[model samples]
Every structure is written in C-alpha cells, then in structure tokens.
Target: MAVLEATNPAFEQFVRDTVLNMPAARHLGFEFGRIAPGDVEIIQPYREELTQHDGFVQGGVLGSLADFAAGCAAGTLLPPGWVNMTIDYTVKILAPAKGEKLVARGRVVKAGPVMTVAAADVYSADGAEETLCATAFVTMRNIRAARS
Candidate 1:
C-alpha cells in the first residue's frame, strides 16, 4: 500500500480534535491507529455493550467504525479549515467480529472539490490473527467549516 502524507502538519491533531472527540466516538472508545493524507485507521476495543446477543460485535457498530474511518480518511485530504461529511455509505458484514479489538482501515478512492469517495475494510484482531469482518464504501461531501 502506498502511504500518503498529509499536507497539513496538524492533520493528526485535527482528526483527534474533530473525529475522536465526537460524542459517539468518545462513547464507543474509538482511537486513532493511523492518520495520513487519504488514509486512516481507527481502532475500537472490544466491549461487552457493543456486542450482540451472540457475543459478536453488532453490525451497526461495525458500520459506524467503517463510516468514521472512511470519513476521516476523506477529511485528511481536505484543505485547511475544510471538513467532510458522510453523505452516504454502504457496509457489508462478512464475518462475526469476535476478537479483542476491531481495526478499520480506510483509504480515499477519489477526491474532488465538493465530494470524495472512500472505502474501508474492517478486521477483527485476535492476538496475532486478524479476520476480515466487514467492508464499506463511503461518499463524503466536502465543505468549509462555518466560523463560530
């Protein structure tokens, strides 16, 4: 995989301040694994509350992880003071997310002035093994942040 570096020197901090600080992300305990231009990785530690009756991580949780990772990846490519919002996303759960943690790797497919397309692959990590659990494609609308 080609690694893309962010033009913004503070992009990592920007992601932490905007993405990781969101209420839902904070509540779900999502953390940054990696953040770069057009790429990102988010980690969600396994929690009992996030699991379904069968003890596997819920589909909704997986979808949320994929969405956040992809959106953040798109955000990394935005110009300074710009942000991206998820307009649409589709997630497919392929396996039971039974593991110690979940890692979502997201990469931008294409970026434009007003829109960006991204994709994410979610994996369930158990010790040294990782299983592909879900995948997602996301579309984001790029917009300038409104001054407060």
Candidate 2:
C-alpha cells in the first residue's frame, strides 16, 4: 500500500476513538495496532469462547475483525464529520483458524467521494509463525453528517 496522509488532520485520533467506541470491537477484544492513512491493522487474541465445535475460531469473529479493519482504512480518507460504512463485503477462508491470535491488515485500493474499496488479509499467528487464514474485499460508502 502506498503511504498517504489523511486530508483531515485529526483523522488518526478520530479513528482511534471510533474503534474504542465500537461495541463489536470491544466485545471481540480487538486491539488497534496501526492506524495510518489508508491502512489499518486489528488484532484479537484467540479464546475458547470464540471458537466453534471444531476448536477453530469461528468465521463470524474473523469476518467482524476484517470488516472493522477495512472500514477504518476507508474512513481514513473521508472528511471530518463523514463516516464510511461497508456496503459490500466478500471473504474467502483459506485455511483453518487455529492459532494463538488473529491479525488482519487492511489497505485501501481506491478512495472516492462516494465509495471506497479496500482489502484485508487475515492471518493466524501461532508462536512465531503466521499463516494466511482469510482474505476479504470490502466496498464502503461515505456518509456525511445530516443537515439539521
């Protein structure tokens, strides 16, 4: 991903604060590791409660992590008072999610006033090894603050 700066100077703080306020993120124990313009990373520790009967991390948890990372990357390009929400999302689960933790890195491919496209790669990290577990492509629409 090309390094870019957000048009809104306070975007970094906004993104961080937004993530802190997201109930899904909080419930999933997602940690925002990096938040750069057009790029973001979210990490979550593996927990038995988040696993399925097969002992693999549930797909829903992975999907939520990817969506949050992708949406934040897209939001970095939006103006202040404007937010981006995912309109379309597609994910491909590549491998079993068996690891000590999960990390997702998302990057914005295209950012426009109306829509943005981003992709996230989810990895399963076990000790010192990290394996690709899933990939997601997300499209988001910008939402401006409503006029009173």
Candidate 3:
C-alpha cells in the first residue's frame, strides 16, 4: 500500500479543533496523538465509568473511538473547510480491553471527492505493552462545513 500524506498544511489543527469541539469526544477525554494526511491516532484514557461489569472498557466506547479515529483520518484528506462524517461503520471486538488506556490508529483506505473509506485498529495499552482489542472499517461522506 502507498503511504498517504496530508495535503492541508493545517490538517493537524483542523483535526484537533474538530475533535475538541465535539461533545462526545470531549466527554470521553480523547487525546490527539499522531496526525498525518491519511492517518490519525486517538487516545482514550481508562476511567471506571467507562468500563463494563468485568472492568474492561465497554464495547460501545471502543466502537466510538474507532469511528472517530477513522473519520478523522478521512477528514485529513479533505480540502480545507471540508469535513467528513461517518456514514457507516463496522467494528469487531477481538479481545477484552484491560489496560490503562486505549489507543486507536486510523488510516484512510481510499479517498474520493464525496466519500472515503477508512479503517482503525484499537489497542489496549498497559505500561509498556499493548494488546489488539478491536478493529473497525468505516465509510465517510465528505461535506463542506457551513461558514460562520
């Protein structure tokens, strides 16, 4: 696969701003990690409230992180002032997420004018080890945001 680079010089800032302004992302305390043209990483710190009965991170939270990460990856390839929204997504849980935090690595699979395909791998991170917990494939629709 060919490596993808960001066309927008302010892509990092754009993704940061977009994520920061989102209520769910903010509530989940999502942190920005790597931000590239066609790749992005989002980190979610573990909280008791976000865990399931067995103290593992909830599946819904994992899916949400994957969706956000994948959508942001596609958004990085969009033109300035353009944003992408998740039209559809599928996630598979492979293992229980038991760790200090979760890291989601997202990459664009294909980018087009109106739609984009992306995928993400979610990992449960301990002090120095990480375990793959989930994977997701996402489809996004690109749209120009209304200017204020």
Candidate 4:
C-alpha cells in the first residue's frame, strides 16, 4: 500500500463535504470552527433529539463529533488516495454537557504512513465563556482506497 497522497483536507470545505455525505448525521448541522492544516474545530448544538432524559448530550453524539474532527485533522496530513479509519479511541468526560452548543477542538498529534493519532476536547460554549466537558484520543488506520 503506497502512502496516501491528498488523502483528505483538514479545513472547512473538507468537513462540510464529508458531513454532508454522511447519512444519519446529515441533520446534525455541525459547524467547523477552525479549519486549518492539521487542526479542526467544530460546534454542535444541543438538541433534544440527541439527548437523554437528563437533557444532556449523548455519549454517541460526543463520540461522533470527536471522530469527525479527529478524522479531519488526520486527513490534513494523509497523502492522496488514502482514507483514515478509527482503530482505537479513549474518552474522558469531565463535566456535564450544558449550554446552547458544544465546541470541539481536534488536532493531529502525529501523522504517519500506517497510522494517524489525534486528540480532541469537547467544551460547553456559552456567552463569552467555555467549559470542558470531555476529551478524547483517537488512533486511525491509514490505507489506500479500493476501486471496484
């Protein structure tokens, strides 16, 4: 498997394209905040459809946000013809999810031929303030895309 070139981009356009392409999450309406090389930021609103009885953000939603951002971060570095897959991940929730929106910051710590590692943090976004809610580390597999 040759090193992937132009794998994916870690920017607003890349994120928009990918999210729009996804089926289930298409309605989530994620907003990419900081879309630069090797870095990605996003904001996801708190919606009743994505919450539990306690009215908190679902773990799955949080995980998806982390995964999406991490992938974008890794994509910025991956060569073309290659796509990234989440091989492993860990998350730690620090506080309850509250506020109108959740902010996520995901960035690539390391990008290699076989693997790409990324870290992300979720925060509660309020007026001129933010609070940490969760954090995650994701390791992704880098491989060539198959053509049928």
lDDT of each: 0.91, 0.88, 0.93, 0.78
Candidate 2 lDDT by residue in tens digits, 88-127: 9999999989888999999898999999999999999988
Q: For candidate 4, which ten residues in a row score worst on lDDT?
A: 1-10
Residues 16-135, model 3: lDDT tens digits: 998889999889998989988899999999999999899999999999999999999998888888888899999999999989999999999999999999999999999989999999
Q: Higher TM-score: candidate 2 or 4?
A: 2
In candidate 4 the C-alpha lDDT for residue 50 amounts to 82
Task: Give the TM-score (vs. native) of candidate 3.
Answer: 0.97
TM-score of each: 0.95, 0.93, 0.97, 0.85
What TM-score does candidate 1 reach?
0.95
**Local lDDT at 103 for model 1:** 97
Worst 10 residues of 1 by lDDT: 1-10
Model number with the top TM-score: 3
Q: What overall lDDT, based on C-alpha atoms, would model 3 receive against the true structure?
A: 0.93
**Candidate 1 residue pairs in backbone clash:** none
Q: Rate residue 48 of model 1 by lDDT.
A: 97
User: Please, what are the lDDT tens digits per residue for candidate 1 over residues 14-118?
Assistant: 877898668899899989898888889999999999998878999999999999999999888877898889999999999999899999999999888899999
lDDT leader: 3
Model 1, runs deviating above 4 Å: 1-5
Task: Write the number of the candidate with greater TM-score, choosing between 1 and 4.
Answer: 1
Ranking by lDDT: 3, 1, 2, 4
User: lDDT score, residue 105, model 4?
Assistant: 88
